[model samples]
Target: MTMPAFVKPRQVIGHHLVLRDATPADAEFIVALRTDESKSRFISKTSSDVSQQVAWLEKYAQDNSQVYFIMEDREHNPVGTVRLYDQQGDSFCWGSWVIREGSPSGYAVESALMVYQFALSLGFTRAHFDVRKGNESVWKFHERFGAVRTEETELDYFYSLSREAIDKSLAKYAKFLPGGIQVIAA
Candidate 1:
């Protein structure tokens, strides 16, 4: 199937959450999440300086190749962040997923479903991503979502989920997102 070029949406609404484009004002929240001692271990190290994060976000805003999102609760209170990038043909890589310590139980699953659903609507038929070797919970979550482990390096485990797998997940998790996702173009 021919896919149109990817266009970032202004907002993606899930059953219980909202994912909106990250702005420079979100630098502090993003920094805090990235710098969290427990969470930072698996991801790349980022500077603690908010201004540096702002600058990075500024650059990110100008780059249309990726969509960085701030995940929020239905009330619009920010709870986490995720990003979709590294498009290669019909597949895209997604990571930078992090939920706040006290978020409700299903945010991770819902946010992930939103990502897949939104991407599918944009014509991406497959998803590719990597998890740190030590991030057991996350990798296991992907496995449960039908992502097959495709490659393994000393430091990371790469995985992929085809359109079929993603479709299965959307069905299996229908209750968590009963109405499906709705993306409003930016």
Candidate 2:
């Protein structure tokens, strides 16, 4: 199904930032973001060449099971991206990588909000993600959203949360978010 244009365009956040879908045109930026040493280390993936990135973006654009969005700053500069994929039944997987390198305040919050919105749009009962084993900061961040660790491997830690849990957690933190940050489902 085709998403509405309003939802497809830039989603504003308190007049400071926007979140929107990524395109094949974002290949260069995505390559750079993926290559950043710190980000790469945590994500456990190597950077792709421009051609490879373009191909990957093409595949993503054609895949209904995945949605990727680019986060832009006030000036409309693309700074980072988040991806939601692997939808099956009521379960889906999510992943995010921010390569803004000293981004403004609330970037992480914005990313989390996007994840919540996407999961809801997909009608997912639960969303899951994995953080590298040593990425304590990210693990704690997920915990703050009420995500519980369900599995721990030598290399990564897995976290999952039900739809009810996500909604309750969002409600619990609503007062802390910026005004106009609506969670829209597809």
Candidate 3:
């Protein structure tokens, strides 16, 4: 059977938030979050310059191997970002999840659910990602979502979640996105 191509949906609308494809215009916002002292501690470091981020985004536009998104609330206010990449057969990796401080509650759960739903729709059966060793809250969240600890390194904890686990998590958190998400075509 022919494998499915990665999807780059224009939008994935949920109950409280919507994820839209990232653009160069979001460079400053992305840079701001990536450079925030409190938020940057767990994720990889990036250049603080918005122009650099713009260049990176321009390059990213040509790469179909990944999908990057900027999350927004109903009013179209930017709140966070997430990405899916590093595909290997039926498995894919997702990361760069960061939500703005002071945002309303339940966003985290909704974002995770939306990500899994979007990935599943693209035909990915499993996911593998690493959480920083110091990011206890994130790792714990994944554990509670049924992701298994597969290994670890000096700075990060690797985890794996099968399709079954993903489905379970989606069901468990169904309340957060009771109406499910609406994916708009690219």
Candidate 4:
């Protein structure tokens, strides 16, 4: 049997945010963005130096196992990033972060929606994420997007959403969204 395609590049937009894949030239910005203490807390890995970041970026450019996107404002200012990885079969793991302090509201939610839409476009049936413990706000945010808590472990809380759930959440939020929120297929 032939393996099915489950990945692709995509662009998504919200009222004040846009999400798209990172380019080779984004290494420097990514390095700076990931080094922030607040931003790095929830991330599983950290770059110790610029060279390390560059190497990671090079690998990311070549890797089919992961997809990364930079979140930007209306004026094209970078505010944060989101990544989807560990894709196997019909499930994938994902995460997002806002690198700049108080850059704007809605960065995380916009990034989340982008990733969810991307996953659906990729033929994924479900998506999952690990939220750090004690981050009640983040938990609530995920729940607001229709991610239900699926598992609780010593390190983090796991949440998941199926394609049906994602669609329902999007439809439910459509009335509250501004005119700019849209998911463009890759």
- Worst ten-residue run, lDDT, model 1? 1-10
Candidate 4 residue spans exceeding 4 A from truth: 1-10, 175-186
The segments of candidate 3 whose C-alpha lies over 4 angstroms from its true place after superposition are none
Q: Candidate 3 residues 32-117, lDDT tens each?
A: 98898888989989899899999999998889999999999999999999999999888889999999988888999999999999
List the candidates' TM-scores in order.
0.97, 0.83, 0.97, 0.83
On the 0 to 100 scale, the lDDT of residue 31 in model 2 is 84
Q: Write the per-residue lDDT of candidate 2 for residues 23-84, one digit (tens) a residue.
A: 88999998888888867778756456798888888887767667788878768799888777
lDDT of 2: 0.71
Give the poorly placed runs of model 1, Cα more than 4 Å off.
Answer: none
lDDT of 3 at 179: 90
Tens digit of per-residue lDDT, candidate 4, span 1-186: 333244545667766777777776777788787777777776666675777777777888778788788888878888877788876678788775555788756566555666666676667778788898777788788787788888999878998877788887767665434453466666
Model 2 misplaced stretches (Cα beyond 4 Å): 1-15, 180-186
The lDDT per prediction is 0.92, 0.71, 0.92, 0.72
* Local distance difference test, candidate 1: 0.92
Error of 3 at 171 (Å): 0.8
